[model samples]
Target: MPIQHINPPGLLQFDAMSQVVVASGGRTVYIAGQSASDVNFEVVGGNDYYAQSVQALRNLRTAVEAAGGSVENIVSSTVYLKNLTPEIAGRFLEALAIACEGKSFPPHAFSLIGVASLAGADLLVEITAVAVIDAAVAA
Candidate 1:
């Protein structure tokens, strides 16, 4: 594996994500921010944060796979949420679990940012990720 997840002892560890990630000897892949838009550029979820979150994560997965990598290859991510709150964040986590096929999301360095708006009016969440994959896999 080219990626290593670490939650140092002193740092507050969360089951859904890792505090740190170490990537070695692989081609770094930078994924653009993905929202709930579908292949037709239409938003999949409307006015529903959880639904949009799930769709956004699914889009992120699609991008990673397109780069010849899996969600497990993700080393870092930045999540942007519109009008975020604790309850909304919980919903996002739930959506993440669902996106990961009922399993916990792959551990990775992550940042969550509350935003006033996104590219689309209906988009409630957007995810940007970075992954490291073997050169052979990328070929």
Candidate 2:
């Protein structure tokens, strides 16, 4: 990946992202926001937020990986949940941490929001992420 880690003499690079992610020599891929849908596009986990969250992440991972990037390469993520509360957010974080075990430089920019409803009645959560895969790697 041409995504180089930047450092300023007195700055904390670990907590901050590169000022500008130069993707010149790499292929940029954009994945539409993904919902918790199965192979048949049938939304999963009707009323179960946690289950739906799990499924959403799984779906997001699959899409990103298919595009030549892994979840670990994800630089940003946005999660939309229905009726999200502090407790529910914590649960989602926990699940995310578990799923990212052993993956370095896990998602840096993360956003979570609660929405009134999703596209389908059975959908409870949706996740979208951006990853940079070096063009050389993809080639």
Candidate 3:
């Protein structure tokens, strides 16, 4: 599949959503809200935002790849947190940075949201994304 990126002049030249158009066409994989849970479906991080965010991202990655996708296939991701604070946001970014280490992941549309809770009480973060895989390419 062919992908195109567009960045207008009006908005700030930021990474996420600093542009308008993302991809042209492909097979879309819609990942559900992935929480900080392991194969057993138990929350990995208790109340820690950083730990939870990291685990959530990891979960998201696994789901995407299992569905015949990859990190580079992700076109957009939404991060849902228990609270949206500067410190928390920083921690989340840190977690993301660590998780993306030694990977071919690229920046995509990102949005952060503050929610009262998630699937479980102890969970603190949930990540969901849209991945586009070319039909000719296998996974």
TM-score of each: 0.92, 0.73, 0.83
Which should have the higher TM-score, number 2 or number 3? 3
- List the candidate numbers ranked by TM-score, top first: 1, 3, 2
Question: Which segments of model 3 are wrong by more than 4 Å?
Answer: 14-21, 101-105, 135-139
| Predictions in order: lDDT | 0.85, 0.66, 0.75
Model 3 Cα displacement at 120 (Å)? 0.2
At residue 100, candidate 1 shows an lDDT of 74
lDDT tens per residue, model 3, 1-139: 5444556677666543425436646888899999998888898887888888778878888898898877767777888988688899878877876665534235666788988888878888988888887733222
Looking at candidate 3, what is the lDDT of residue 42? 90
Rank the candidate models, highest lDDT first. Answer: 1, 3, 2
> C-alpha displacement of 87 in model 1, angstroms?
1.1
Candidate 1 lDDT over residue span 105-127, tens digit each: 77788888999999978788999
Q: Model 3 compared with the native: what TM-score?
A: 0.83
Cα lDDT of model 2 overall? 0.66
- Model 2, C-alpha of 136: deviation from truth (Å): 10
Q: Identify the leading candidate in terms of lDDT.
A: 1
Pairs of residues clashing in candidate 2: none
Q: What TM-score does candidate 1 get on C-alpha atoms?
A: 0.92
